[model samples]
Target: MMRNLMRIEIYDTTLRDGTQAENFNISVDDKLRIAQELDTLGVDFIEGGWPGSNPVTIEFFNRIGEIDLKHSKIVAFGSTRHIKNRPEEDANLQALLAAKTPAIIIFGKSWDIHATDALNISLEENLQIIEDSLAYLRPHVEHLFYDAEHFFDGFKNNEEYALKTVASAIAGGAERIVLCDTNGGTLPHEIPPIIKRVKEFVAGLSETVGLGIHPHNDSDSAVANALMAASSGVEQIQGTMNGFGERCGNANLTSIIPALVFKMGFDCGVKEHISRLYGCSRLVTELANLPHNHYQPYVGKSAFAHKGGIHVSAVKRNPLTYEHIAPELVGNSRRILLSDQAGRANILFKAKEWGIHIRPDDPILPAIIKELKELENLGYQYEAAEASFELIMRKLLGLRRNYFSFQGFRVTDNKYRMDKPPLTEATIRLSVGGVEVHTAAGGDGPVNALDSAIRKALIRFYPILEEMELVDFKVRVLSGEYGTEAKVRVLIESRDGEESWGTVGVSVNIIEASWQALIDSITYKLMKEEKK
Candidate 1:
């Protein structure tokens, strides 16, 4: 298929629209950091936020000016002037001007129902507000955009009135008129015809103005809709990073960018820096304190993972047979998952990755695969806990050295008073370099106490262990049939200055499971140091 060769502007609303997502909150500093990263990624426009809405947003506008951006134009977003106040007198417009951004965007009611019911105003008066607001700010800003809120629905309900709103925005000097899928109800098939009519309407009125699409993901088709709109001749795409927004989310630019460049053959400012797409996606989620969706498209961990024996074999011989594009194109690497379904190809691929040489015909290869399947049957998931799997592989090959021997450990939690919190303490003994070391420590909980005690026992012998810290801990109950007696699985994520790795442990006793994970985490750190 011939790809669409057009220049499409990339507009990112991650700092503004993305913050509306539940539990996806970030500080002003975080917004600044994200803005810098977006600029580095070469987005054409970064919608800072609704500057008039909150103090944090106002502060963001104030602080963003200090950092000199190289590519993206910082945009301040707001609504049209109020009914009671003139355009210059409206506080929202005033806030946008105060932001002193190179570009400004103001959304106005396009659906006649919103003007009548939501704004409690006549349809004609709404048109006046939309036009006057843009006219007032026309000379002050270098670039001006008018977002016709709910344009798709409004066009469906009252086509004449919706076109009238677009006419108002054009009359007031909007450089770009963006049709918004505010409720995200528009389908991909529904996009082209509407956009075709709107493009005709705009061409009839003015030749210099352009059209843009701002789509939400309520129908899980925002990306599709945006692509369809582009195919239908829209010049710009507006979306948030990782699809973070109110309700479902805005269209995800992370998925949209690569698709546009690699699949659709569109050119944009970020095309040269597209390899940063995966890292940029991870940074946004990390700063928001949210776990990266392993199954997400393009940038997900499992996007290029091969598991089935035939699939792995085929991928090892030729990736294009089973893969769409090179994972490295988006800064992601292929993962050969070592599950029960995985075969020799997966094991050999992993061995090469870890610098462990093993012959394809080695007699021990089948034994290693058998032991891996047995451990998985016993509920050991090696996919997420790769460090533990690596240790097992080394031990089976007789290549692993014993850095420490586990002696014993005890934990106690006592509550002296009803009004006070419980006291938790742990004592641990270990033999390192044939020297026995015993220590005790207290913590906020049993697992924490145990972690502290182990660190105390080992830090003196291996000072490098001090650089390692548990960044994340997750516990999952395997089943509910046995209720409290059911087995629990603990996954711990540890990181030093250089890198991070995951380790997993499972047992009926939660503490024992945690201990097993902790032991693996420490051992992995030591193993890495010894290899270096």
Candidate 2:
């Protein structure tokens, strides 16, 4: 598709609407960090929060006000004036003014159901609320945007009343009249025509106002709906970072911005900073301590991951054969995933990417492939355990270090009474630089005990191991057919002060699997230090 010449304004409401998500939470400091990131990404506007809603929100506006954003205009969000109060007297309107932002977005009911059933107000009163609320704030702020909440549903139900609400906002001086999919159930096919009708309706009134789209992801079509709106000539697109919001989410700007620029050919403010999208997406989820969706469309971990042999070979020859857009265009890199499904092509690509020199005819290539396939047959997965895969590569390439040799290890768990917690202990004997070391440690569990004992045994030779800490441990039963005797795969994430890596192990015995993963974790850490 050809790129559209028209520019679209990007507005992020992550601070306000994003916080409505159940699992997502951030501090005032976090909010400031995110705002700076959004500005760096070249978003047109950032809705800081409603100042009068809470103490944290007010503090957010005050603290963020001190930052000199490079491009984004900070916007404060709130609702229209109360039905019973004048615009000047409304607390929400007063809070929007208190935020002291250059732009403010206020939403009012457009759905007749929300007006009558939710707000218990007449349709006429709602229109007055929309008109007066915007008119009062129009002169106070540099830019005033009005959001018609539940606009799509309202238009479908009562076309006249919905058009009237938008007209009233335009009459009262809303620079941009945003149509919102508040219920988030509107389909993509339903958007363009409605926007066209809206444009025609405004044309008949002999008035023109900026058009905007704010969609939620309840039906999993927010991205599609947003694109439809843009194609229909909307100037502004409102969404949250990583689609964070109350229910499903606000439209995912992370996905939308790139799509608009690359796929749909729409010019957006974020076009220059498009390469930072992946890092920006991760930053938000990281701050919220939420697991990033690995399969998310644009900014996911596996967005460009290749597993099948045919795909790997084809992608190596021509990435366009498998990928829609270049991964680097969005700050993401292609991943040659190592697993049972991987082919020789996958290995070659991974070897080159990881800076491991290898020839297509190298004898070790076949050996490594055989070993990986054998391991996978035994229920080991190397995709998420890159450290383990790296170790295998080093071993096959003769780059491995013999930091320590394990002699033996034993772990015991004792629980004599129901009232008493189990006591776990581990003993390890190993040789470092030909020096035999014996260590014993106690922990909350057997894995922890073994980890402590092994670290105690090796800390003498590789003192740098002291800087390494285990961050996460995950165990999965590879097969449930055998139930208690099923093979288990263990992945251990380890990190030093600077870097992190994951190691994998598989065994029928859980303790053995954990032990294997732990050993690889330490080995990778030591190897990295030695190389430096």
Candidate 3:
């Protein structure tokens, strides 16, 4: 006997609904790039945007029309015919046609209140709006999807009217009736029974009309609701990448797609390409200039990271003992965090993974372990400074070069007037290959000045250092009791075009901490080049 695999459609609205998120906006080029990425990820549909909303949306539709998307159909989004206008005369409806996409998705009011108050039209007139809008686009497009706005609340308040709204859409040849939780407050447990009732009601309307779900994340139940909806036999699941949308956000497809395929035994079409999930999620967040939610499930940096001693040891011995699934299954790698809680197992695993061969009984292992603990006690966190950790490991293994020796450096800050910003300057003296070098430079701040001076002094011996740049710097106070005199830990992130690395230093002096971190950053860069 064969199992029946549920075939689910993934309709992504990252380009449309995602941009509605506060502090989350993408350019036209960003939209095109995301469309191509979704196509490569095997999404069934990509809702471009509301073509008639603004110039940005119109430009997205115009530009995307020129590209040939591989797997996903470009969907132009819009609203139903206005109460005061005909379908052809409505600007929104005409813009959907102008988009020239293979599919069109238009939303209309389903709730009696939204129709009577929001659209300021009679409830009966709203039904005509849904029917006429879908009917007008049905003949022109290969697929037509009608979104029932505020669908769940509509069903709860006026079940008969919501059913009638979906019936009108089906009557006008809508291929799919998408139930939208526009406010995103619907509970997960409420989904299954509600969908069951809708299925029973729609059965009498049309046998071929499919059901889809569009949920927001206001109450953080959007993902749960979407999964429940899919399990309850909704043919289509609509969401945005990384859950970026209005209010809290839309359903996070990064989380949903994996759950549906790996856990629930559903066929979401992207099972083969699901390994790209992490990269896809990060790319969207990166393009939007938003910090990736490190705590996000499935794709977050901390998702599979083990921090406790017992957990790390168990994960090292048998990953499945502590992990729900192999991190690689979602294109993410398992990370055993090294900190105060780290045991010998953590060091052993990290050494082997970094390609530094070390036996369980290696003499240097004990020394490295002792040094790591001492450093961590001083508030040096290696978890975020893996490059520094790796460099220390390599040094213990005798595989690291001296690179260059730091001598001394001085930084000065001066401000002549209250309105004037402080001017920072630094002078560095260092030895490279037994040659003495001295350099001076100015920067916006003390750290930047120190970094410039160091780079100037070392660039002659190691010309490759010119390619490296400090991308991020963060400072944290380990002990706040001292206030201005508190011990600080500095973590510096550097990128050398091909890859990025993090290094750390801790001290009571902020400048000294920064200088230590900067030195380690350069040393790690040299070490990586040597290994390569």
Clashes of each: 0, 1, 0
Top-down lDDT ranking: 1, 2, 3
Q: Summarize candidate 3's per-residue lDDT along 383-464 as a digit string, tens digits.
A: 8899999888887777888988888999999997889999999999899889999889999899999999999998888899
Candidate 1, residues 1-532, lDDT tens digits: the string is: 2476689999999998999999998999999999999999999999999986988898999999999999999999999988999877889999999999999999999999999999999999999999999999999999999999999999999999999999999999999999999999999999999999999999999999999999999999999999999888999999998999999999999899998989889988998999898999999999999989889899999999888888999998999988898999888989988889978888888998998999999988998899889988777788888999999999999988888899999999999999999999999988988899988999989999999999999888889988999988999888644888888999999999999999989999889999999999999999999989
Q: After superposition, how far is residue 430 of candidate 1 from its true place, in Å?
A: 2.1
lDDT, model 2:
0.91
Q: For model 3, which pairs clash?
A: none
Model 1 TM-score on a 0 to 1 scale: 0.98
Q: Write the per-residue lDDT of candidate 2 for residues 83-177, one digit (tens) a residue.
A: 88998899999989988999999999998989999999999999999999999999989999999999999999999999999999998899899
- TM-score winner, 1 or 2: 1
After superposing candidate 3, which stretches have Cα over 4 Å from the reference? 1-4, 397-399
Point to the candidate with the largest TM-score.
Answer: 1
